[model samples]
Target: MSGADRIAAGGVTAHENNRPPKIEIHGIERIFLKKNETNGAQESFVALKDVNLKVESGEFVTVVGPSGCGKSTLLFLLSGLASPSRGEILINGDKVTGPALNCGIVLQGYALFPWRSVRKNIEFGLELKSVPKKERKEISDYYINLVDLTGFENHYPYQLSGGMQQRVAIARVLAYDPDVLLMDEPFAAVDAQTRETMQDELLNIWEKTQKTIVLVTHNIEEAIGLADRVAVMSRNPGTIRDVVPVNLPRPRRIGGVRNTPDFQILSHHIWELLQDKGSRGGSGAQSAAVPRVDIGEHIRDDAVI
Candidate 1:
Protein backbone atom coordinates (compact mmCIF):
# COMPACT_ATOMS: atom_id res chain seq x y z
CA MET A 1 0.00 0.00 0.00
CA SER A 2 2.87 2.42 -0.65
CA GLY A 3 2.57 4.47 -3.82
CA ALA A 4 -0.59 4.24 -5.91
CA ASP A 5 0.88 6.54 -8.52
CA ARG A 6 2.23 5.89 -12.03
CA ILE A 7 4.76 3.05 -12.42
CA ALA A 8 8.05 3.04 -14.38
CA ALA A 9 7.38 -0.19 -16.30
CA GLY A 10 7.50 0.66 -20.02
CA GLY A 11 5.86 3.72 -18.52
CA VAL A 12 2.76 2.98 -16.43
CA THR A 13 -0.68 3.10 -18.03
CA ALA A 14 -3.61 4.85 -16.40
CA HIS A 15 -6.20 2.50 -14.86
CA GLU A 16 -9.97 2.72 -14.39
CA ASN A 17 -11.73 4.12 -11.34
CA ASN A 18 -12.06 2.03 -8.21
CA ARG A 19 -15.37 0.42 -7.31
CA PRO A 20 -16.89 -0.96 -4.09
CA PRO A 21 -15.77 -4.44 -3.03
CA LYS A 22 -17.90 -7.63 -3.16
CA ILE A 23 -16.45 -9.99 -0.51
CA GLU A 24 -15.94 -8.77 3.04
CA ILE A 25 -13.53 -10.06 5.70
CA HIS A 26 -13.07 -8.76 9.22
CA GLY A 27 -10.70 -9.43 12.10
CA ILE A 28 -9.63 -12.88 10.90
CA GLU A 29 -6.85 -15.05 12.39
CA ARG A 30 -5.39 -18.53 11.88
CA ILE A 31 -2.84 -20.55 13.91
CA PHE A 32 -1.05 -23.76 12.92
CA LEU A 33 1.62 -26.23 14.11
CA LYS A 34 3.30 -29.31 12.61
CA LYS A 35 1.51 -31.22 15.40
CA ASN A 36 5.05 -32.52 14.87
CA GLU A 37 7.09 -29.57 13.38
CA THR A 38 8.16 -29.62 17.00
CA ASN A 39 8.24 -33.03 18.63
CA GLY A 40 8.89 -32.07 22.23
CA ALA A 41 6.13 -29.45 22.20
CA GLN A 42 4.46 -28.88 18.84
CA GLU A 43 5.55 -25.33 18.16
CA SER A 44 2.63 -23.06 17.29
CA PHE A 45 2.66 -20.62 14.38
CA VAL A 46 0.14 -17.83 13.95
CA ALA A 47 -0.12 -17.56 10.21
CA LEU A 48 -2.72 -14.81 9.98
CA LYS A 49 -3.88 -11.95 12.17
CA ASP A 50 -6.76 -9.52 11.90
CA VAL A 51 -6.92 -9.60 8.11
CA ASN A 52 -9.72 -7.38 6.80
CA LEU A 53 -10.64 -7.06 3.14
CA LYS A 54 -13.64 -6.53 0.83
CA VAL A 55 -13.79 -7.82 -2.75
CA GLU A 56 -16.61 -6.71 -5.01
CA SER A 57 -18.44 -9.38 -6.99
CA GLY A 58 -16.66 -10.09 -10.28
CA GLU A 59 -13.59 -8.21 -9.14
CA PHE A 60 -10.16 -9.82 -9.41
CA VAL A 61 -8.31 -9.53 -6.11
CA THR A 62 -4.72 -10.67 -5.69
CA VAL A 63 -2.92 -11.11 -2.38
CA VAL A 64 0.88 -10.72 -2.35
CA GLY A 65 3.49 -11.06 0.36
CA PRO A 66 6.80 -12.63 1.40
CA SER A 67 7.17 -16.35 2.09
CA GLY A 68 5.42 -17.65 5.24
CA CYS A 69 3.00 -14.69 5.09
CA GLY A 70 -0.70 -15.72 5.44
CA LYS A 71 -1.70 -15.29 1.79
CA SER A 72 -2.78 -18.90 1.39
CA THR A 73 -4.16 -18.94 4.90
CA LEU A 74 -6.54 -16.16 3.99
CA LEU A 75 -7.59 -18.00 0.83
CA PHE A 76 -8.36 -21.15 2.78
CA LEU A 77 -10.46 -19.19 5.23
CA LEU A 78 -12.47 -17.62 2.42
CA SER A 79 -13.20 -20.99 0.80
CA GLY A 80 -14.11 -22.36 4.24
CA LEU A 81 -11.46 -25.07 3.84
CA ALA A 82 -9.94 -23.99 7.14
CA SER A 83 -11.65 -22.37 10.08
CA PRO A 84 -10.42 -19.14 11.60
CA SER A 85 -9.62 -18.83 15.28
CA ARG A 86 -11.36 -15.46 15.12
CA GLY A 87 -13.41 -13.13 12.85
CA GLU A 88 -16.13 -13.29 10.22
CA ILE A 89 -16.33 -13.61 6.40
CA LEU A 90 -19.44 -12.74 4.43
CA ILE A 91 -20.35 -13.75 0.90
CA ASN A 92 -23.50 -12.26 -0.67
CA GLY A 93 -24.34 -10.97 2.82
CA ASP A 94 -24.20 -14.39 4.48
CA LYS A 95 -21.49 -15.31 6.97
CA VAL A 96 -19.36 -18.32 6.01
CA THR A 97 -18.88 -21.05 8.61
CA GLY A 98 -18.03 -24.08 6.48
CA PRO A 99 -17.23 -25.21 2.95
CA ALA A 100 -19.73 -24.07 0.33
CA LEU A 101 -20.18 -25.54 -3.13
CA ASN A 102 -20.19 -22.16 -4.87
CA CYS A 103 -16.53 -21.58 -4.16
CA GLY A 104 -14.17 -23.18 -6.71
CA ILE A 105 -10.46 -23.52 -6.00
CA VAL A 106 -7.35 -24.01 -8.20
CA LEU A 107 -4.35 -24.57 -6.00
CA GLN A 108 -0.59 -24.34 -6.88
CA GLY A 109 -0.34 -27.72 -8.60
CA TYR A 110 -2.61 -29.87 -10.72
CA ALA A 111 -4.33 -32.34 -8.39
CA LEU A 112 -6.21 -34.15 -11.16
CA PHE A 113 -6.35 -37.96 -11.13
CA PRO A 114 -3.91 -39.63 -13.52
CA TRP A 115 -6.49 -42.27 -14.50
CA ARG A 116 -9.11 -39.74 -15.59
CA SER A 117 -9.29 -38.05 -18.99
CA VAL A 118 -9.74 -34.29 -19.20
CA ARG A 119 -13.53 -34.50 -19.66
CA LYS A 120 -13.99 -37.08 -16.91
CA ASN A 121 -11.87 -35.05 -14.53
CA ILE A 122 -14.11 -32.06 -15.12
CA GLU A 123 -17.17 -34.24 -14.60
CA PHE A 124 -16.00 -35.63 -11.27
CA GLY A 125 -17.52 -32.82 -9.23
CA LEU A 126 -20.89 -33.28 -10.87
CA GLU A 127 -20.78 -37.00 -10.27
CA LEU A 128 -20.30 -36.49 -6.56
CA LYS A 129 -23.22 -34.05 -6.48
CA SER A 130 -25.36 -36.60 -8.39
CA VAL A 131 -25.62 -34.56 -11.56
CA PRO A 132 -26.76 -37.00 -14.29
CA LYS A 133 -24.41 -38.19 -17.03
CA LYS A 134 -26.07 -36.15 -19.78
CA GLU A 135 -25.91 -32.89 -17.83
CA ARG A 136 -22.40 -33.66 -16.65
CA LYS A 137 -21.24 -34.17 -20.21
CA GLU A 138 -22.85 -30.93 -21.29
CA ILE A 139 -21.24 -28.97 -18.46
CA SER A 140 -17.87 -30.67 -18.82
CA ASP A 141 -17.69 -30.16 -22.59
CA TYR A 142 -18.70 -26.55 -22.20
CA TYR A 143 -15.86 -25.88 -19.76
CA ILE A 144 -13.34 -27.82 -21.82
CA ASN A 145 -14.03 -25.46 -24.69
CA LEU A 146 -14.06 -22.50 -22.38
CA VAL A 147 -10.49 -23.32 -21.38
CA ASP A 148 -9.57 -24.01 -25.04
CA LEU A 149 -9.02 -27.70 -24.43
CA THR A 150 -11.89 -29.01 -26.56
CA GLY A 151 -9.73 -31.15 -28.83
CA PHE A 152 -7.82 -32.56 -25.88
CA GLU A 153 -10.90 -33.67 -23.93
CA ASN A 154 -10.01 -37.35 -24.18
CA HIS A 155 -6.36 -36.91 -23.19
CA TYR A 156 -5.30 -38.17 -19.76
CA PRO A 157 -3.38 -36.04 -17.25
CA TYR A 158 -0.23 -38.06 -18.01
CA GLN A 159 -0.46 -37.18 -21.69
CA LEU A 160 -0.93 -33.42 -21.29
CA SER A 161 1.85 -30.91 -20.67
CA GLY A 162 2.03 -29.10 -17.36
CA GLY A 163 0.32 -26.06 -18.85
CA MET A 164 -2.30 -28.22 -20.51
CA GLN A 165 -3.03 -30.00 -17.25
CA GLN A 166 -3.54 -26.64 -15.60
CA ARG A 167 -6.05 -25.79 -18.30
CA VAL A 168 -8.01 -28.92 -17.41
CA ALA A 169 -7.86 -28.02 -13.76
CA ILE A 170 -9.35 -24.64 -14.56
CA ALA A 171 -11.97 -26.29 -16.74
CA ARG A 172 -12.97 -28.52 -13.87
CA VAL A 173 -13.57 -25.51 -11.68
CA LEU A 174 -15.40 -23.73 -14.45
CA ALA A 175 -17.70 -26.73 -14.63
CA TYR A 176 -18.35 -26.23 -10.93
CA ASP A 177 -19.13 -22.60 -11.82
CA PRO A 178 -18.31 -21.21 -8.43
CA ASP A 179 -19.30 -17.61 -7.87
CA VAL A 180 -15.97 -16.99 -6.20
CA LEU A 181 -12.71 -18.51 -7.48
CA LEU A 182 -9.91 -19.18 -5.00
CA MET A 183 -6.51 -19.86 -6.54
CA ASP A 184 -3.30 -20.42 -4.57
CA GLU A 185 -0.26 -19.62 -6.71
CA PRO A 186 -1.97 -21.58 -9.53
CA PHE A 187 0.80 -20.94 -12.03
CA ALA A 188 3.91 -21.13 -9.84
CA ALA A 189 5.03 -24.44 -11.30
CA VAL A 190 4.91 -23.38 -14.96
CA ASP A 191 7.74 -21.75 -16.90
CA ALA A 192 7.59 -18.00 -17.55
CA GLN A 193 6.23 -18.28 -21.10
CA THR A 194 3.60 -20.82 -20.08
CA ARG A 195 2.75 -18.77 -17.02
CA GLU A 196 1.97 -15.79 -19.23
CA THR A 197 -0.30 -17.87 -21.41
CA MET A 198 -2.11 -19.21 -18.35
CA GLN A 199 -2.54 -15.69 -17.05
CA ASP A 200 -4.11 -14.65 -20.35
CA GLU A 201 -6.46 -17.62 -20.23
CA LEU A 202 -7.39 -16.72 -16.67
CA LEU A 203 -8.43 -13.24 -17.74
CA ASN A 204 -10.54 -14.61 -20.55
CA ILE A 205 -12.28 -17.08 -18.26
CA TRP A 206 -12.85 -14.39 -15.64
CA GLU A 207 -14.32 -12.01 -18.19
CA LYS A 208 -16.58 -14.63 -19.64
CA THR A 209 -17.70 -16.16 -16.36
CA GLN A 210 -17.72 -13.02 -14.19
CA LYS A 211 -16.70 -15.02 -11.11
CA THR A 212 -15.34 -13.20 -8.08
CA ILE A 213 -11.66 -14.14 -7.81
CA VAL A 214 -9.00 -14.10 -5.09
CA LEU A 215 -5.52 -15.18 -6.12
CA VAL A 216 -2.55 -15.61 -3.76
CA THR A 217 0.94 -15.03 -5.15
CA HIS A 218 4.43 -14.04 -4.02
CA ASN A 219 5.10 -12.20 -7.29
CA ILE A 220 4.48 -8.41 -7.17
CA GLU A 221 4.34 -7.95 -10.95
CA GLU A 222 1.85 -10.78 -11.23
CA ALA A 223 -0.20 -9.19 -8.48
CA ILE A 224 -0.38 -5.88 -10.36
CA GLY A 225 -0.79 -7.41 -13.80
CA LEU A 226 -3.84 -9.55 -13.00
CA ALA A 227 -5.67 -8.10 -10.01
CA ASP A 228 -8.28 -5.39 -10.06
CA ARG A 229 -7.13 -4.83 -6.48
CA VAL A 230 -3.88 -5.99 -4.94
CA ALA A 231 -3.97 -6.77 -1.20
CA VAL A 232 -0.55 -6.76 0.46
CA MET A 233 0.08 -8.73 3.64
CA SER A 234 2.73 -8.71 6.35
CA ARG A 235 4.81 -11.74 7.44
CA ASN A 236 3.72 -14.52 9.82
CA PRO A 237 0.92 -13.73 12.27
CA GLY A 238 0.06 -12.07 8.97
CA THR A 239 -2.37 -9.22 8.47
CA ILE A 240 -3.35 -7.29 5.36
CA ARG A 241 -1.12 -4.24 4.92
CA ASP A 242 -3.10 -2.55 2.13
CA VAL A 243 -5.55 -3.06 -0.70
CA VAL A 244 -4.50 -1.02 -3.74
CA PRO A 245 -6.89 -0.72 -6.67
CA VAL A 246 -5.43 -1.39 -10.12
CA ASN A 247 -6.76 1.34 -12.40
CA LEU A 248 -5.32 -0.21 -15.55
CA PRO A 249 -7.88 -0.40 -18.37
CA ARG A 250 -9.67 -3.47 -19.79
CA PRO A 251 -9.19 -5.70 -22.86
CA ARG A 252 -5.66 -5.51 -21.48
CA ARG A 253 -3.23 -8.18 -22.62
CA ILE A 254 -0.50 -9.46 -20.24
CA GLY A 255 2.77 -8.11 -21.74
CA GLY A 256 1.20 -4.74 -22.58
CA VAL A 257 -0.19 -4.32 -19.05
CA ARG A 258 3.16 -5.12 -17.39
CA ASN A 259 4.88 -2.36 -19.32
CA THR A 260 2.25 0.29 -18.44
CA PRO A 261 3.15 3.48 -16.56
CA ASP A 262 0.62 2.77 -13.80
CA PHE A 263 2.06 -0.71 -13.30
CA GLN A 264 5.55 0.75 -12.80
CA ILE A 265 4.23 3.36 -10.39
CA LEU A 266 2.26 0.89 -8.26
CA SER A 267 5.04 -1.71 -8.42
CA HIS A 268 7.59 0.80 -7.11
CA HIS A 269 5.20 1.92 -4.42
CA ILE A 270 4.64 -1.66 -3.25
CA TRP A 271 8.36 -2.41 -3.53
CA GLU A 272 9.06 0.60 -1.34
CA LEU A 273 6.68 -0.69 1.32
CA LEU A 274 8.40 -4.09 1.37
CA GLN A 275 11.79 -2.37 1.57
CA ASP A 276 10.64 -0.09 4.39
CA LYS A 277 9.36 -3.10 6.29
CA GLY A 278 12.83 -4.66 6.05
CA SER A 279 14.46 -1.36 6.98
CA ARG A 280 12.07 -0.87 9.88
CA GLY A 281 12.73 -4.48 10.92
CA GLY A 282 9.20 -5.79 10.31
CA SER A 283 7.61 -7.81 13.09
CA GLY A 284 4.20 -9.48 12.80
CA ALA A 285 2.78 -6.42 14.56
CA GLN A 286 2.89 -4.03 11.57
CA SER A 287 0.80 -0.89 11.22
CA ALA A 288 -2.65 -1.10 9.60
CA ALA A 289 -1.53 1.02 6.65
CA VAL A 290 -0.48 -0.80 3.47
CA PRO A 291 1.81 1.68 1.71
CA ARG A 292 0.08 3.55 -1.12
CA VAL A 293 -0.47 7.01 -2.68
CA ASP A 294 -4.10 7.25 -3.77
CA ILE A 295 -5.26 7.97 -7.32
CA GLY A 296 -6.00 11.54 -6.23
CA GLU A 297 -2.40 11.83 -4.97
CA HIS A 298 -3.69 11.77 -1.40
CA ILE A 299 -2.16 9.17 0.93
CA ARG A 300 -4.33 6.51 2.62
CA ASP A 301 -4.69 6.26 6.40
CA ASP A 302 -6.04 3.56 8.76
CA ALA A 303 -6.44 2.33 12.34
CA VAL A 304 -6.90 -1.45 12.73
CA ILE A 305 -9.41 -2.43 15.40
Candidate 2:
Protein backbone atom coordinates (compact mmCIF):
# COMPACT_ATOMS: atom_id res chain seq x y z
CA MET A 1 0.00 0.00 0.00
CA SER A 2 1.13 3.56 -0.67
CA GLY A 3 1.69 6.19 2.01
CA ALA A 4 -1.25 8.22 0.73
CA ASP A 5 -3.48 5.16 0.94
CA ARG A 6 -2.28 4.49 4.49
CA ILE A 7 -3.22 8.03 5.55
CA ALA A 8 -6.62 7.68 3.92
CA ALA A 9 -7.24 4.27 5.50
CA GLY A 10 -6.70 5.74 8.96
CA GLY A 11 -9.39 8.37 8.50
CA VAL A 12 -12.97 8.02 9.83
CA THR A 13 -14.48 4.75 8.66
CA ALA A 14 -18.20 4.20 8.31
CA HIS A 15 -17.91 0.71 9.77
CA GLU A 16 -16.06 2.09 12.79
CA ASN A 17 -18.87 4.58 13.33
CA ASN A 18 -21.43 1.75 12.92
CA ARG A 19 -22.88 3.27 9.71
CA PRO A 20 -21.82 1.34 6.63
CA PRO A 21 -20.74 3.36 3.64
CA LYS A 22 -23.01 3.36 0.61
CA ILE A 23 -19.93 3.58 -1.59
CA GLU A 24 -16.34 2.58 -0.75
CA ILE A 25 -13.23 2.87 -2.88
CA HIS A 26 -10.37 0.80 -1.43
CA GLY A 27 -6.75 1.37 -2.52
CA ILE A 28 -7.59 2.02 -6.17
CA GLU A 29 -5.02 2.65 -8.90
CA ARG A 30 -5.42 3.16 -12.63
CA ILE A 31 -2.55 2.84 -15.09
CA PHE A 32 -2.59 3.38 -18.83
CA LEU A 33 0.07 2.21 -21.26
CA LYS A 34 1.22 4.88 -23.65
CA LYS A 35 3.47 4.20 -26.60
CA ASN A 36 6.06 6.71 -27.77
CA GLU A 37 5.33 7.52 -31.40
CA THR A 38 8.97 8.29 -32.24
CA ASN A 39 10.54 5.09 -30.89
CA GLY A 40 7.56 2.81 -30.31
CA ALA A 41 8.59 2.55 -26.66
CA GLN A 42 5.78 1.89 -24.18
CA GLU A 43 5.49 3.71 -20.86
CA SER A 44 3.05 3.30 -17.98
CA PHE A 45 1.16 6.42 -16.91
CA VAL A 46 -0.30 6.30 -13.44
CA ALA A 47 -3.57 8.20 -13.50
CA LEU A 48 -4.51 7.35 -9.90
CA LYS A 49 -2.57 5.86 -7.00
CA ASP A 50 -3.95 4.00 -4.03
CA VAL A 51 -7.01 6.26 -3.69
CA ASN A 52 -9.49 5.58 -0.89
CA LEU A 53 -12.90 7.04 -0.14
CA LYS A 54 -16.19 6.31 1.64
CA VAL A 55 -19.62 7.91 1.08
CA GLU A 56 -22.56 7.33 3.37
CA SER A 57 -25.99 6.58 1.97
CA GLY A 58 -27.57 9.63 0.29
CA GLU A 59 -24.45 11.71 0.91
CA PHE A 60 -23.39 14.26 -1.72
CA VAL A 61 -19.64 14.17 -2.42
CA THR A 62 -17.68 16.16 -4.99
CA VAL A 63 -14.12 15.52 -6.13
CA VAL A 64 -12.14 18.55 -7.33
CA GLY A 65 -8.57 18.97 -8.56
CA PRO A 66 -6.45 20.39 -11.37
CA SER A 67 -6.58 18.88 -14.82
CA GLY A 68 -4.99 15.42 -15.07
CA CYS A 69 -5.68 14.73 -11.39
CA GLY A 70 -7.80 11.67 -12.27
CA LYS A 71 -11.04 12.99 -10.80
CA SER A 72 -13.01 11.81 -13.83
CA THR A 73 -11.08 8.55 -13.89
CA LEU A 74 -12.19 7.79 -10.36
CA LEU A 75 -15.81 8.48 -11.35
CA PHE A 76 -15.46 6.10 -14.26
CA LEU A 77 -14.14 3.46 -11.89
CA LEU A 78 -17.10 3.93 -9.59
CA SER A 79 -19.51 3.64 -12.52
CA GLY A 80 -17.84 0.40 -13.63
CA LEU A 81 -17.20 1.91 -17.07
CA ALA A 82 -13.49 1.48 -16.44
CA SER A 83 -11.84 -1.04 -14.16
CA PRO A 84 -9.07 -0.10 -11.74
CA SER A 85 -5.74 -1.84 -12.22
CA ARG A 86 -5.60 -2.36 -8.46
CA GLY A 87 -7.98 -2.38 -5.45
CA GLU A 88 -11.72 -2.81 -5.36
CA ILE A 89 -14.88 -0.70 -5.41
CA LEU A 90 -18.07 -1.53 -3.57
CA ILE A 91 -21.59 -0.09 -3.82
CA ASN A 92 -24.15 -1.02 -1.17
CA GLY A 93 -21.65 -3.54 0.29
CA ASP A 94 -21.44 -5.50 -2.95
CA LYS A 95 -18.30 -5.52 -5.10
CA VAL A 96 -18.81 -3.71 -8.42
CA THR A 97 -17.94 -6.24 -11.11
CA GLY A 98 -19.37 -4.36 -14.06
CA PRO A 99 -21.84 -1.65 -14.98
CA ALA A 100 -24.82 -2.32 -12.71
CA LEU A 101 -28.40 -1.06 -12.99
CA ASN A 102 -28.03 0.66 -9.63
CA CYS A 103 -25.59 3.19 -11.13
CA GLY A 104 -26.56 6.00 -13.54
CA ILE A 105 -23.98 8.26 -15.18
CA VAL A 106 -24.32 11.73 -16.69
CA LEU A 107 -21.42 13.06 -18.69
CA GLN A 108 -20.36 16.58 -19.67
CA GLY A 109 -21.74 16.16 -23.15
CA TYR A 110 -25.54 15.94 -23.17
CA ALA A 111 -25.36 12.64 -25.13
CA LEU A 112 -29.03 12.92 -25.96
CA PHE A 113 -30.10 11.34 -29.20
CA PRO A 114 -30.77 14.07 -31.73
CA TRP A 115 -33.56 12.06 -33.29
CA ARG A 116 -35.44 11.57 -30.05
CA SER A 117 -37.82 14.00 -28.36
CA VAL A 118 -37.27 15.05 -24.73
CA ARG A 119 -39.87 12.65 -23.36
CA LYS A 120 -38.65 9.87 -25.63
CA ASN A 121 -35.04 10.47 -24.58
CA ILE A 122 -36.01 10.30 -20.93
CA GLU A 123 -37.86 7.08 -21.59
CA PHE A 124 -34.95 5.44 -23.44
CA GLY A 125 -33.72 3.54 -20.41
CA LEU A 126 -37.17 2.31 -19.53
CA GLU A 127 -37.57 1.17 -23.09
CA LEU A 128 -34.43 -0.95 -22.67
CA LYS A 129 -35.96 -2.50 -19.57
CA SER A 130 -39.06 -3.38 -21.69
CA VAL A 131 -41.38 -1.29 -19.54
CA PRO A 132 -44.89 -0.89 -20.92
CA LYS A 133 -45.53 2.29 -22.89
CA LYS A 134 -48.00 3.72 -20.33
CA GLU A 135 -45.71 2.97 -17.40
CA ARG A 136 -42.72 4.46 -19.22
CA LYS A 137 -44.68 7.62 -19.92
CA GLU A 138 -45.70 7.83 -16.27
CA ILE A 139 -42.10 7.54 -15.01
CA SER A 140 -40.80 9.94 -17.64
CA ASP A 141 -43.54 12.44 -16.80
CA TYR A 142 -42.62 12.34 -13.11
CA TYR A 143 -38.93 13.05 -13.79
CA ILE A 144 -39.74 15.70 -16.38
CA ASN A 145 -41.78 17.61 -13.83
CA LEU A 146 -39.11 17.03 -11.20
CA VAL A 147 -36.57 18.64 -13.52
CA ASP A 148 -39.02 21.38 -14.58
CA LEU A 149 -39.02 20.20 -18.16
CA THR A 150 -42.72 19.32 -18.31
CA GLY A 151 -43.63 21.74 -21.09
CA PHE A 152 -40.51 20.89 -23.13
CA GLU A 153 -41.16 17.18 -23.40
CA ASN A 154 -42.01 17.35 -27.09
CA HIS A 155 -38.93 19.46 -27.90
CA TYR A 156 -35.73 17.97 -29.32
CA PRO A 157 -32.18 18.38 -28.02
CA TYR A 158 -31.26 20.98 -30.65
CA GLN A 159 -34.48 22.82 -29.90
CA LEU A 160 -33.39 23.41 -26.31
CA SER A 161 -30.57 25.41 -24.73
CA GLY A 162 -27.45 23.79 -23.31
CA GLY A 163 -28.84 23.89 -19.79
CA MET A 164 -32.17 22.51 -20.91
CA GLN A 165 -30.47 19.66 -22.77
CA GLN A 166 -28.49 18.86 -19.65
CA ARG A 167 -31.68 18.81 -17.62
CA VAL A 168 -33.14 16.36 -20.06
CA ALA A 169 -30.05 14.21 -19.61
CA ILE A 170 -30.45 14.27 -15.85
CA ALA A 171 -34.15 13.43 -16.02
CA ARG A 172 -33.38 10.50 -18.28
CA VAL A 173 -30.95 9.17 -15.68
CA LEU A 174 -33.47 9.60 -12.90
CA ALA A 175 -36.16 7.87 -14.95
CA TYR A 176 -33.99 4.78 -14.82
CA ASP A 177 -34.28 4.93 -11.01
CA PRO A 178 -30.60 4.37 -10.20
CA ASP A 179 -29.53 4.32 -6.57
CA VAL A 180 -26.47 6.45 -7.29
CA LEU A 181 -25.77 9.30 -9.72
CA LEU A 182 -22.25 9.87 -11.04
CA MET A 183 -21.85 13.19 -12.84
CA ASP A 184 -18.60 14.21 -14.57
CA GLU A 185 -18.61 18.01 -14.92
CA PRO A 186 -22.23 18.03 -16.02
CA PHE A 187 -22.35 21.81 -16.07
CA ALA A 188 -18.95 22.70 -17.44
CA ALA A 189 -20.23 23.61 -20.87
CA VAL A 190 -23.15 25.70 -19.68
CA ASP A 191 -22.95 29.47 -19.26
CA ALA A 192 -22.22 30.96 -15.83
CA GLN A 193 -25.80 32.01 -15.09
CA THR A 194 -27.17 28.73 -16.37
CA ARG A 195 -24.59 26.75 -14.40
CA GLU A 196 -25.68 28.37 -11.16
CA THR A 197 -29.33 27.65 -11.89
CA MET A 198 -28.46 24.07 -12.79
CA GLN A 199 -26.54 23.65 -9.55
CA ASP A 200 -29.60 24.67 -7.57
CA GLU A 201 -31.76 22.38 -9.65
CA LEU A 202 -29.38 19.48 -9.05
CA LEU A 203 -29.42 20.04 -5.29
CA ASN A 204 -33.19 20.13 -5.25
CA ILE A 205 -33.31 16.92 -7.24
CA TRP A 206 -30.82 15.30 -4.87
CA GLU A 207 -32.95 16.25 -1.89
CA LYS A 208 -36.09 14.93 -3.52
CA THR A 209 -34.53 11.65 -4.71
CA GLN A 210 -32.21 11.05 -1.74
CA LYS A 211 -29.76 9.15 -3.95
CA THR A 212 -26.05 9.05 -3.25
CA ILE A 213 -24.35 11.41 -5.72
CA VAL A 214 -20.68 11.78 -6.65
CA LEU A 215 -19.73 14.62 -8.99
CA VAL A 216 -16.31 15.47 -10.41
CA THR A 217 -15.50 19.06 -11.43
CA HIS A 218 -12.60 21.47 -11.72
CA ASN A 219 -14.56 24.43 -10.36
CA ILE A 220 -13.71 25.01 -6.68
CA GLU A 221 -16.79 27.05 -5.85
CA GLU A 222 -19.08 24.52 -7.49
CA ALA A 223 -17.42 21.72 -5.53
CA ILE A 224 -17.86 23.52 -2.21
CA GLY A 225 -21.38 24.73 -2.87
CA LEU A 226 -22.85 21.42 -4.00
CA ALA A 227 -21.11 18.85 -1.87
CA ASP A 228 -21.45 17.89 1.79
CA ARG A 229 -17.76 16.99 1.53
CA VAL A 230 -15.34 18.08 -1.17
CA ALA A 231 -12.45 15.70 -1.85
CA VAL A 232 -9.41 17.69 -2.94
CA MET A 233 -7.00 15.75 -5.11
CA SER A 234 -3.37 16.28 -6.13
CA ARG A 235 -1.99 15.97 -9.64
CA ASN A 236 0.85 13.75 -10.98
CA PRO A 237 -0.10 10.45 -9.30
CA GLY A 238 -3.61 11.79 -8.63
CA THR A 239 -4.04 10.97 -4.92
CA ILE A 240 -6.63 12.66 -2.73
CA ARG A 241 -4.92 15.43 -0.74
CA ASP A 242 -7.77 16.16 1.64
CA VAL A 243 -11.51 15.98 2.14
CA VAL A 244 -13.03 19.30 3.31
CA PRO A 245 -16.53 19.17 4.72
CA VAL A 246 -18.90 22.02 3.87
CA ASN A 247 -20.47 23.08 7.18
CA LEU A 248 -22.82 25.64 5.68
CA PRO A 249 -26.53 25.15 6.33
CA ARG A 250 -28.54 23.27 3.74
CA PRO A 251 -31.29 24.56 1.41
CA ARG A 252 -28.32 26.61 0.25
CA ARG A 253 -28.48 28.87 -2.77
CA ILE A 254 -25.22 29.58 -4.56
CA GLY A 255 -25.91 33.31 -4.66
CA GLY A 256 -26.36 33.35 -0.87
CA VAL A 257 -23.94 30.60 0.17
CA ARG A 258 -21.02 31.67 -2.02
CA ASN A 259 -20.91 35.07 -0.31
CA THR A 260 -20.96 33.63 3.20
CA PRO A 261 -17.85 34.00 5.38
CA ASP A 262 -17.79 30.28 6.07
CA PHE A 263 -17.86 29.54 2.39
CA GLN A 264 -15.00 31.95 1.67
CA ILE A 265 -12.88 30.41 4.43
CA LEU A 266 -13.30 26.88 3.14
CA SER A 267 -12.72 28.05 -0.42
CA HIS A 268 -9.46 29.72 0.53
CA HIS A 269 -8.35 26.71 2.54
CA ILE A 270 -8.96 24.42 -0.45
CA TRP A 271 -7.20 26.86 -2.80
CA GLU A 272 -4.16 26.86 -0.52
CA LEU A 273 -4.12 23.06 -0.45
CA LEU A 274 -4.23 22.86 -4.24
CA GLN A 275 -1.54 25.51 -4.64
CA ASP A 276 0.68 23.87 -2.01
CA LYS A 277 0.37 20.51 -3.75
CA GLY A 278 1.34 22.01 -7.10
CA SER A 279 4.41 23.68 -5.58
CA ARG A 280 5.49 20.41 -4.01
CA GLY A 281 5.20 18.56 -7.35
CA GLY A 282 1.98 16.78 -6.37
CA SER A 283 3.55 14.32 -3.94
CA GLY A 284 0.90 12.71 -1.72
CA ALA A 285 3.48 11.43 0.79
CA GLN A 286 3.85 14.89 2.36
CA SER A 287 0.71 16.39 3.92
CA ALA A 288 0.63 20.13 4.59
CA ALA A 289 -1.50 22.15 6.99
CA VAL A 290 -3.93 24.65 5.47
CA PRO A 291 -3.47 28.20 6.73
CA ARG A 292 -6.70 29.94 7.68
CA VAL A 293 -7.04 33.62 6.75
CA ASP A 294 -9.71 36.11 7.74
CA ILE A 295 -11.30 37.66 4.67
CA GLY A 296 -12.86 40.76 6.31
CA GLU A 297 -15.12 42.01 9.09
CA HIS A 298 -18.81 41.03 9.35
CA ILE A 299 -17.90 37.37 8.80
CA ARG A 300 -18.07 34.92 11.69
CA ASP A 301 -14.71 34.26 13.39
CA ASP A 302 -15.59 30.59 13.83
CA ALA A 303 -16.18 30.31 10.09
CA VAL A 304 -12.63 29.19 9.39
CA ILE A 305 -12.63 25.53 10.26
- Clash numbers, per candidate: 27, 0
User: For model 2, what is the alpha-carbon lDDT of residue 106?
Assistant: 94
TM of each candidate vs. truth: 0.84, 0.86
Tell me the tens digit of each residue's lDDT in model 1 across 1-305: 33353322322221223544457898888888757644667776788887888777888989977666788878888988888888899877778888888787887797998899999999988998899999999999788888888789889999998899988888887788789999998887888889888998899888888889999887777888888778877664587776667777786667887876677778766665544432332342443253323311221111000
Q: Which stretches of candidate 1 lie over 4 Å from their true place?
A: 1-21, 35-39, 277-305
Q: Which candidate is the best by lDDT?
A: 2
Residue 24 miss distance in model 2 (angstroms) = 0.4
In model 2, the Cα lDDT at residue 113 comes to: 94
Return the top candidate by TM-score.
Answer: 2
Residue-wise C-alpha lDDT for candidate 2, range 61-102, written one tens digit per residue:
999877777999998999999999999999999999889999
